[model samples]
Target: MPYPFRLNAVASLFVAIAPGAFAAEPDQIPQDMNVVIVSGSRVEHTSFDFPAAIDVVDASRIQDSQMRVNVSEALSAVPGLVAQNRQNYAQDLQISSRGFGARSAFGVRGIRLISDGVPATMPDGQGQPSAFNLDMAERIEVLRGPFSALYGNHSGGVIQLFTRDGQGRPTLEVNTAAGSDGQRKLDVNAQGSSAGIGYVLDVSRFETDGYRDHSAATRDQGFVKLTTAPTAGGKLTFTANSLEQDGTQDPLGTTWATYQANPRANEIDSTDTQSPKRTIADRYNTRKDISHKQAGLAYDQQFGDDRLHVMVYGGNRQVKQFQAFSKFLQVSPSQSGGVIDFDRDFYGADINYAFVRPLGDGKLTTTVGLEYGHSTDDRSGYENFIGNTFGQEGALRRDEQDKLKTMDPYAQAEWQVGQWVLTGGVRRTKLTVGVNDAFLSNGNDSGGVSFSHTTPVLGALYKINPLLNVYASAARGFETPTLNELFYSGSGAGFNFGLRAAESTHLEVGVKAIVMTNTRVNAALFQVRTSDELVVDTAIGGRTSYKNASATLRQGGELSVDTKLGAGFSGRVAVTVLRAVYDEAFGKVTTGSRLPGVPNANAFAEVAWKDKSERIGAALEAIASSNVYADDANADIPAPGYAILNARFNARQTWQGWNFKEFVRINNLLGRQYVGSVIVGDANKRYYEGAPGRNWMAGIGANYAF
Candidate 1:
């Protein structure tokens, strides 16, 4: 994801500028407030330096919200993006920007996700980065479009997460929360520093009976970070974060007939949860379990006017799943003891360097970095009840695993003039892929390798004033074919290494304005052109092959207004509009076909009031959206549009009016019906009917501090 461009022309034209002699006065930074920024982009520093889009959400926005899970959940209210919960109790979700709403194979679409300045994506460029602790995060910065060259490949927009750190005296915190649908959450976080060493440890265990049948999910997450500053010249940081999850298996997308037969149960909802007769007649229950671990180390050094940073990180994940009843409809039923196991591991290193030099007129900043990593997978599919015992076709030994390794090198530079900011970056990539298929007659494994073009971007930021900024930029991004996409030839002609990489070009323009001392407005418009975009061929049904489309275009804009209401009452509102199209005459698709899965718009608004004296707080919010389609053809089968409203009220108090505090919260103030996921395959293959209707609960919680 290196962003390279023709900066010589811009630098040539920007030479005639003033010296240390500048015009603007000191930045009117909010005295006590913090500005969480997406690192790499100067957009966080000033709006005028880049003609692109960048968003910063402060800590207050998070603490007052009712979101659980990951950053996407917390950002569900943000404009320009859509967050969808699959409701399987797996911390399952889908978040997309521009025109990529329903494309949830792995996770977010064309968006680069980062945590604590480290890359949070799979080597194949497709996979969900597990949600770290949202409560411990200080702020989140989101940059939209291809111009986000600072971080390489999958260079779609970028999200940078920053965790809270030691501010002063050492402290310890403990909290617990529980609500309806058998929900409960317990958290403990502590921070302290001694002997030039600082540390933060956050741990949480959360569980829920779920809003629906077969929807139960539970997870335990913990992270410990240690930072040491040996001398005024150097700092070292070591971090270890781990997560364990187990619950109901994957939810099967069902049809209206299946739903009408049993509205409360899932395609695999367990009858065991009920009575003998009830379980004997019901066949809608299913279940799944998974675990993941991650750890890393980083170092930073400061030498006078420059700073140096280097980091190496990696992780491993495993999943165990079971499904039934569906076997009655598919190739075979996973009845009895039918189950599957999947395990994966990844470890890589990110090395980078940055320096600043003073020139005659102004200053020049340059950066170059190289990233190399290896990711491997060993999967064995075993059916506890394989063979005729379960009336299934696959054997007990049926299983598959894939191994892949990739190397990428990237570089970038930023030049500052009187009032203009110019920048560029680029990266080259090479990959090798191998697959182990139990059913294949070829060999134990099959392999293929290839090299690809670099992802690149260029941008400019123009600061009109201390409170006004405008920017624009263009970037090129590419994603290599994944293992399944390259070698897993399914029922039809399985794998095709012949498939090309998914590529994209993003163009953007936007402005940031501080309306007043207490309010701010940020907005941006973007259009992305993508070629060889991966799309499943449904015409043949179950047969998978990728076709390189001529080119698909997606355009959209986002607007957000944040205001400090003063007192303890504050609010914010945001809206987004997106459109996608692909005018290609291929397969069943004729010319002028709109892209499928992408939504037209997403909107959210919230209001909250807090009273420490009264020991009370309440918040009300709404998330609404338009319809979605199964295909660009816009046919009869479609996902309808829906809206949801949520309200929360919490009261806090002290025991002796000092030592400890307790609080209670009421969630799901209004219950509503909806659908969260729509997968491809069978005509009836659909995950339907969201959280059950009309259920409420209240829980008393306490927090201890030392």
Candidate 2:
């Protein structure tokens, strides 16, 4: 179907459902409106009254019948966000919000990631979601649109995970799961509160033989948390986490011909004369090893009608990756080689004070905050072959010391009175990046660049009635080039300081309503106009370069409806329609060309049933997305549009201080074949990454309390 038709169809479906849903009696408004969120304002407030696009995935939805290994599993129902597992653990998850981070070749960019009040993103705005410990997550709050600008640079959107605090009786739990393709997981956790102090600890390991050729991985994670009231009216929290993955194989993307021939086949290394059928991944032993550890402390104090909050965190990460670049590619002196090694240390702190007072006929709350972050990296690159032995580190090609520092000061206020709620905020951010070239054999390439921006946001919401709210918001935001993006120019030169930051203007209008007495609906229309938009210029052999393009425009609408069907049944639907394209021609990319990697439309729907005791449940889910382009010119075979079905069943039982739970799930129930994701602008046309056809997983858990 045409993109416009797909969008209209989704919109019409919502329109058809709204009238009947809103006909319920006014007195039947659900109490779910009381759910509090803190992502938009830095203070607790109901999402219904917050004038921005935000969604919350509670613990039940995050953990039930799931492997809990990747956040992508739980985020499909969130409109305006795309999270793809890639099925390649070596590169980590790919996440983009509203087309902001769609061009990312790896990891997460253009978005902010926070956990337990500490930033998971680095000072340069690159984040690794693999660091998150989902076993302890209580809820994940996703904030989009104008309000995200308040978080400073590269804040296209924000996703924050809050862990559950230990309380009640002490308990210990163990879980084990196994599935197709040799996938398996084991997890153990303990939590309790003693003498006014709370503690939680978790450890888990996951392994998979992978559905695609030459893709295999193993990961181990650990988390610890402690909470206590150290003084009257004051509470302190401490958290620590670690993640380790060694020798995770990377199944590089395949050419369209190869994918069509065999979705599970690897890209053959045509240059290998001795073994013609040997795949590039097998020939080069493409893989990555990562080790990461972090710790954070947060303290909050209440004084009458005011509050003080402070957070400090520090971490270190080490990574070694081997890429599948051919030997010929390294003949150029400017080439950074095929082996990447980096060790980084990072630390940051945030301090804020909130004051509350009465103004006119309303109550006003204001917060002033300061944030500082720093990171230093010892980086080096090496050739991937030594004496014809591929995959072994050869001669060193480049070495550098890279440092990033950021400081931001921001303030925001919220006032609520009668039927009106008003909010405004501003942030001034300064970022400095410096690189010192240690190996000058390829020529001295060292420099420093700094960027500064002041962003402001404003929003207003009006309560149309006890069951409905309408809101509008606007803001200015900016995204600076990440270290990876700046590492190489289009010509393969080192560190392109000429790259400019992308600045944007955002506008949004939305509605929040309770319908059918037991249903909640959120709908939004948004637009973003950006100058100096960052785009992929070239990609070859696992190395990608970025360049700033002409102005771009993104206009979209999002709708999410969640309702109770009674009889212990529920249903949910989330739809997104986005039109992202270049507004002006630039470098062969004509005006109106759709942005690569972003689909024109996507949707998710689910129907679930549970026993009255909530001990047995099942759900049927459908996920669909329109086709997406692979290049700036829209000149390649696009990943075809696809829809898939999934089903899951879970059961629970409790007996004398013990709890037992088990679940079984089947994905891609129809055994459809499709590409799950793409590597945009791949110069070699190896753009498609195939998803699994059909898969099953079963798990069981046992908990004991004392």
Candidate 3:
């Protein structure tokens, strides 16, 4: 739908423009030959190597794109994808595929996330959604499917984000930027190979004044990668990912009356007239720090009937999480309280084997894997108020703890002949959960363990012609409740009751084709049926508790296309359409009901023209999303949709017509007001207001050869 130009002319009197942007284009470099065996394919060979579709984001494009601080937004350059944040800089993100989704604080739905062969997820499978260092990223590979057997530990498909290996020429780079709301950034990266060893190091600092009132965010990150060769047949690699940050929340929270009066009011100003005495000091101030250590070894060699490939990995992940604030004046301004501390640790090991054999006119590939892991969560907290009466010596002190362990095994096989391929696999998992609560009102141990049944994947891929192929597949996926959801009771984010397992079955049919000599497009249509969905039962007469009364259905299509515009110019575009619904006893909703934060359709387009010899280039891009549902109840009030247009100009030419090896980019050329997403939807079924309206971000980048 197009907004009337005439209306815009009249509305200009009251509107202030804040500008920014989405666009996807064809792959920059086109490959004419080879049936590349991509990882997402649990299947072995053929043009449509795997029944489930896959997308890859390589390094060269990452650097050329001029993407800002939003990792997910930059990724929109890839077709069939769109991403947005829920909070200003909370690093909390939501991603969807084929219109199906599972909303959580971390990890992702129907997709497994592994970085450097290590599960990026914590022991509970709750992943850290914002720890990425885009500057050092080597490539991002995605596998879409419910075919979970290969890595059944997670029901979603798999997305592997590989850090830089520092191949070929030695490189040293520095990047800096300044944008709207006093946002600033400094990023540095370096890599080189010497003798028989290679090394990579990177560090960065990013800060923002925030879009809305009290919406500021700051982040610091550092990473390193090392490679060594000992024996001729083996190699060892070590890496670390870490971050520290502090941020203010949003100004968009509002009660029904405040929203009706002014949905755009900041948190400190919005209020219920009945509670006019309320003070803003009670608002929340949050912060966090996360660090991980990882290392691994791999061996590959020929062994009779098969070429052996083996990899073993182990790592430790630590999180220091904090949240607190004093001053809910209306609830009790005299009362000041918060959680003093929370800590957790995760550790794990993995072993994998892949063997291939030549058979008939085709080939056979078999893979076997084993995993053993454990997690521990220990917490202590305190709450105090300026009340008239004093209670006991240890009245407000409390402690709680939980531990979990998992041991799993899985296998799969693929056989291919002519244009036909077959694949099948299964996985069995064993789990145990234990907990302890020092302040248990019932005076009891508060922990228990549970095991999940087996989940499997089945699919096939067919080649229709040299330029195209088609596939169909079916598989099962599930999610277990988190520790906080089962034991914590008093904290607002804490849970009073346990949640049941969340499960779904996905079926899809898709096609992959090279549209022309320089363009390729991949598209898929999928549907999912889910049961035992976790939902709040306020009717239980207390805080939100989990129940399995909800059933859900999702259906959608994804299309991505990329092409070479010309010698030094290229472009890409992607679109997604989705429908999700929740069918519970209280409300039997039909299809087309949108999921929380999910837009009905998302699209992107980008074009870049470069002159490498002169070290000069310019790029233009546009990204737009349709309206989205701001609440889980599928309410009528939606987050109005908006579009962003951006442009960049870079040059390495010297002042005297000579040339240097550096360039710069400017973003949000036109300022515009916009919301990040219905990301902060309330239970009342309304959307949260978004961040700073107009931002002007500019950055300079350079690379030098040793």
Candidate 4:
């Protein structure tokens, strides 16, 4: 089928399943309309009245009958959001929102990440989703489109996880899970409240022998949270968490030929004259070790109709990694070697005050705030071979001290009167980056650069009736190059300070409505225009250099429908259609070239059933995505589009003060061979990351309350 026709068909299917297709049933209205969200405006408000696209994944959807290891397992149900488990733990999950962050080779960029009112993204706009503790998450809120600009820098979108607070009776819980390919997990947790103070503690360990060859990993994590109310209208919270991983093997991507021959096979090292069968990963022992620890404190006070909030946090991270670069590549004097070692220390704070009052015939709420963040990294690089023996660190080639700092001051106001709601906000941000080169034999690359921008957003909503709302929003945002993006120029020179930050304009129109009493629907149309957009100039042996492109355009539509289908059954569907392309030609990339790593269309659907007591349940899900390109020129063979089916069953029982639950899940029921993700712009043409054909997992949990 033609791409345009296929896209239109998907859009038509979404409309057919949405609420507008059915007649309204006022008497059977569901209570979900009362759900409250705390994103976009930083205040409690129903999503139905908000002038933006926002979705919430509740605790049940995140934990029930799931591995609860990777956030991608739950985020797939959100439209306009693409989350993939690369099956290579060393590299982390690949997540992108509305075509943004799709070109990232490792970790996450372009989007903002937050946990428990603390920023997870660094001041340089890079983030690690692996830092989130899924077991303790109460809910995750996703905000997209123009309203996302309110968060300041690199705000392509916003994802925030809120942890559950300890309350009620003291409880102790234990959970264990085992899955295909030697995957296993064990977790223990305790929570209670005493003397007006609440506390929660959690510990977990996970090990996997990976679905692909030469991939294995183990992870240990610990978390603690404490809460107290010291005065009449004052509350304080403290949270701490740590994650550790040692010797996690990295299975680099494979070429199309290798993937077709054997989906689980690693790339062979043709240059290894002594061992013809050895793979590049095995030759260099590509692996990573990581240690991360963080702590945060938050205080909130209420002064009648006004409120004040303050948060402070600090963290440290250490990483050592070995890449599969051949020894011959390091002969260049300017080369940074193949082994990377870095230790980072970061700290940040946020303070905000909100005032509520009456203006004219409407109620007005205003917020003013300041945010500051800083980070320093001690980094060094070395060759991955010693005396002709591969897999050993040798001969330091680079050393440096890198620092980043950011400050932002912003204000926002919202007014509501009768059937009209209006909102406006502005933020001014300044970011500074400095580098001190210690290994100067290659040349002194020490330098500093600063970037500043002022972003403004405006939104308006009209309530056509109690059941329907239409809104529009517009904003201006910007994203600066991360520390890693500044490491090398297109010509392999050090410290590319000449690179400029990308600026963007966003516009969106959306609708939220309840048509049939038990059915709710949300749809949005959005467009983004960017200048000085970043693109990969060259990528070799895990080292990538970036350059700015002329202009780019991204336009898309998202639709989501949720409904209770009666008789103990429910159904949900989410669909997205996006067109991302370069608006002007640059170098070898032509004007109409599609953005690499982004699919033109994708969708998810699910149907579930439960018994009256909610003690037994079952569900079936379908997921699909369109083909994706691997480079700016679209010259290589694209990853083929695919659809997969999954099924799960769960049971629960209660005895005395103890509750027990067990679940079993099977994914890729048809045993299909497909690429789960891609490494964009790989110089070696090793872009395909294969997904597992068929897999199964089972877990059991017991909780006792006293």
Candidate 5:
């Protein structure tokens, strides 16, 4: 479809919805709703009152989504953010805010991820979101734009998940679901409060046959939280969580010809020696097995108008992965082989003090904080075959230990002056990375790099009317190379000390308004200019290198509307338009070329119907995106524009002290055949990953209280 045609379709729908948006029955309007955000300010502030682009996804939305396996399920309606499920479990989700983190092959970068006050992103900015437990999530807050820089490195944006604390009486709940492609999931949870103590615990298991060949996975997760008030003005909280993935298949990407032949086909065909009659992913057993455990403690106390908060957290992760490397590549001495093993230990602490006092007729609040974090990695690589035997570790290729440490001092202030609010923050970060080469066979190519930066943001919001606010902000942010990026230097087995950090300047202006009694609208315009932008230097046989580009530019706008229709229907729509391109060329990439892995335009719309009795409900959703490029050269095959329709129906009943509910969701109702995601800048041009056609899932749950 043409871009203009798609825009027209979306515009027509907006016109059709305007009637209901403006036709407001004051008496029918529900009480004004205010969402409190914690990610942007590390404090509580009404969403509209916050001078940034922030979005909140509540538990109800998460529980009612079709694909609860990833954050993409509930975030489709959020503008300025793109989340794609690759259907290849090994790579996890492909997430990007604006033009940031678009080139990542696996895991997330250029964005900060937090869970219940604990950092999921390491000091190097690499993050994994597979451990998020949706069953117990109270809310997820997404902060974008300049204010995100306050979080230090890789602060292009922030996604923070806060779980629910136990309340009321002791209760138990169980949930189970089954879906297309032989997917199954089960969850159990318990919560209660007693003797000034509150507790919540949840455990879940999931398995899938997957949508493509050689794509299958089984996963387990557990979470627990305990909270108590030990003194009159003090509170303490402890949280623990663990995740395990026994088998996650890596289907890998496919070439344009191969995708045209069979989108589900693996990289290797039937003539390879590894199997002679099977695909490479199946024959070589390309997969990853992983285990992770994390725990954290938080303390809060108040003394008159001054407050104190402290947090301590630690975690460890172990992973083993097998890849499909051709025999020719394995013959080279420089090749790192196809088997990877890594164990990581990370720990961090944060302490802050807040003071509130009177300034003139208004009030001024100031916060001072310090944070420290450290991580160590024991990494090794080995050949995937020995003699005629495949799928087993052979000769050791690379072995090393890498360590990263970071310390930051930060301060922020917010002042209320009559009809205006001023906010500002600054953070000074110091980071050091070191490596030790343990395998003398490759020579001692060990070296380290250190980086330091100071980022600051300033913003102001003016309340023109009781229901309208306008704000503008600007900030400087920087991103250091991730540990994985530094793992290999083209010269040999050593750190990539030649790589430089990318720095950016972000500017944004936005408005928030209550257009009607039951209608709200928010919009923002943003621009970012980056120096020494990171780009893929080389990618060969599953191994990659990175370098810095001269410059890049990103400009975009986002619009969102939420309104409550008459009776029990509510509707929401969000649209994003972006123009991201290289300002200066690097290698074969040319100036003015569109950045890879980002769609120029995307939109989401949803309408839901519920009853006052709260026993029955239904929802209809639509998601659409423009075409996206898969390579920096802008000439490799592109994923075409696509639209998907989904419907969900749910109902619940209460009897005695027990509650029972059921839900059914149908996705891709139009049976759309399209590419779901891509691996950016694949040297062999194997970049496409296909999405599944029409699928369905049904779930049932029961809760009992005493």
Candidate 6:
């Protein structure tokens, strides 16, 4: 009776009729096209032949857009993915793919994040996007749908970033930019290749007097990469990155009343007792400071039809935050604290072997891999006040040691026939988590939980002709509870060992078409049924608790098109429509209610003009989305939909082996006021994070090649 069930029937019927409908005729098949993707299979394949819904944001787009501050700047057009800049540096960007990670209050969850073959996401499926250095990024690949199960746990989808390697002659470049709201940035980099070695190094600093009061922040980052060839067929790459933030303020969310009255105002204290109820956030000073560093090495070798790949990486992160909690909540002995402190060290290693051999008039490629990862956290909480002074660490309320380890072994095979590609993969994942509670004044609460699951995937891609390709896939995906979710117990102390892993069955069908030499279109229909879906119970004072619900069903469709409209003009469009709802009721939740933070519809379109010489270009873009509920109850609040316009202009010139470029961009071109993100189910009733109005940024850069 509902949309999910109806969509399911339609998708099944389409798949059943695909064979005969596509077998009518055969045309000359084109060779490898212009696009190649490695995210779908962990191996390179043509875009149309990948049998998945994947989008590639190339380097030109990344560099030309306003992505230096946030990745969402370049990802607004991607279908089935919602990337929003919260404008609050404390929590980073809020990203969700088809309702998978909409509940994350901080960082990313329920998705695997990879950068240059190294895992950016820890074993527990928690990731921080602040560590991403987009200034040096080459491209970003987003993969959704069934085949993503091959990446192991938390594979609702996968976002992989690939950085460019040094090539051609040596070059040095510098960039500087400034804009409204006191925003400024400076970046310097050098890249080159010589002999048998290639190197890239970059350093940057960003500072902004944010649009909201008391929201200014500054960040510094450094990155380095090196590649060398030792033996005949052996290559090694080393990478290191670091980030440091200072005075990153948290403006916090606002209630509906406060938003409509004064969007820039902080949360007010109703019980202050003073004549004028003053703002609490400014008085208490909510802020977060972070430092992170990571390094990794990868080695690759080939022997005839067999290839081996090995990678090892490690990182450390430290965080300290001051919250806006009042002293009344600290009286309870069970209360952790208003201030949070964390120190974490993580490391991992991966090894894979791939063999390509002949099999029955076709080629068979088999891959076997082993992955191991471990992480340890020294996490603690303290009162936000010491005597009469607030915003300082007081008495220690909680201290604990949390550790997680995971091991996964996987195997995959692909058989390429005349016009069909068949693929299959399986992965067995084992996870162990434990906690040692050090603060035992109240009681001794230390426990652990273990989770294991075997996920499998099967897929097929048929090339009906040079103009069309169709694909279908089925898989199983599993996600374990994140470390943060295991921190506090619902009733008493200790880790929530009672929490269960969320599992899902995924099915998808898709089509890719090349209508003309310069026009491309892609579409996909997908459904997922998840049991033991994690639902939020409460969120207060920067802490949240989660519990499992009975089941949820999510069904969706996505369409994207890119075309060369006319002479030197190009256009693109992407649309996504989805319905995610609880299939079974738990407590006060009713079945068929829409999922929180996930809109039913989203769309984006863009048009650009550029000369054949590529010396000048301009683009106009528009984005829109439907309303979304703010909580599971579906009655607390609703985040209204919005439409926004953005524009960009660029020009470049070359003189004496030196290239110079100037660019400018305007966001929220209409100066529209809107809510950019929501804090789902906030117990404090602070739900809406407001977006800034029209803003402009201009920059210039120069590079010299020798």
The Cα RMSD of model 1 versus the native structure comes to 6.3
Give the winner by lDDT: 2
Residue 83 displacement (Å), model 5: 0.9
Q: How accurate is candidate 4 locally (lDDT)?
A: 0.90
Name the 10 consecutive residues with the lowest summed lDDT in model 1.
12-21
CA lDDT, every model vs. true structure: 0.61, 0.91, 0.57, 0.90, 0.85, 0.84
Poorest stretch of ten by lDDT in candidate 2: 1-10
Which of the two, 1 or 3, has more lDDT? 1
- What global local distance difference test value does model 5 have? 0.85
Candidate rank order under lDDT: 2, 4, 5, 6, 1, 3
Q: Clashing residue pairs, candidate 6?
A: none
Q: Please give each candidate's TM-score.
A: 0.85, 0.97, 0.82, 0.96, 0.95, 0.95
Q: Where does model 4 exceed 4 Å of error?
A: 1-28, 327-336
Task: Put down candidate 4 lDDT per residue, 1-706, tens digits, no spaces.
Answer: 2232244544564465454534565445676654789898887888888999999999988999887889999899999999999999899989999888899888889899998988889999998888888888899999999998989888899999988888888999999999999999999999989889898999999999999998899999999999999988999999998889899999999999999999888999887888999999998899999998999999999999899999999999999999977534546422537889999999999999999999989999999999999999999999887866777788998899999999999999999988999999999999999999999988999999999999999999988667777788999999899888998887767889988999999988877878667778888888898999999988876888898987988888898989889889999999999988998999889997999989999999999999999999999999999999999999899999999999999999999999999999999999999999999998899999999999999999999999
Tens-digit per-residue lDDT, 1-706, candidate 5: 2232244543454454455545654344444445778676776778888899998988888886443578888778889999888887787888899878888878899988899989989999999888677788988998889999999999899999899998899999999999998899999999999998899999998899999888999889999999999987888999999989977988888887777777777776443655566776776688999998999999989888778999999999999998876543446623537888999999999999989999998889899999999999998989887766556788998788989999999999999889898999999998999989898775785779999999999999988656667788899999999988876665434668889899999988877766667888887888888999887766655666787876988888888988889788999999999888898987788998999999999999999999999789999999999999998889877998999999999999999999998999999999988989988877778888989889999999999998
**Candidate 6 global TM-score:** 0.95
When summed lDDT is taken over every stretch of 10 residues in candidate 6, the lowest stretch is: 24-33
Query: How many clashes (backbone atoms < 3 Å, residues ≥3 apart in a chain or on different chains) does model 2 have?
Result: 0
Candidate 5: minimum summed lDDT over ten consecutive residues — where? 1-10
**Residue 537 Cα positional deviation in candidate 5, in Å, after optimal superposition:** 1.4
* Candidate 6 whole-model C-alpha lDDT, 0 to 1: 0.84
- lDDT, candidate 2, 1-706, per-residue tens: 2233244654565565557555776656666644799998888888888999999998988899899999999999899998988989998888889988888888889999999999999988999888888988999999999999999988999999999999989999999999988999999999999999999999999999998888899999999999999998999999999999999999999999999999888899887888998999998899999999999999999988799999999999999999977635546523537899999999999999999999999999999999999999999999887766788888898799999999999999999999999999999999999999999987888999999999999999988766677788999999999999889888877888988999999988887877768888888888899999988887888888889988998989898989899999999999999999999899889999999989999999999999999999999999999999989999899999999999999999999999999999999999999999999998989999999998999999999999
* Cα-based RMSD of candidate 4: 2.8
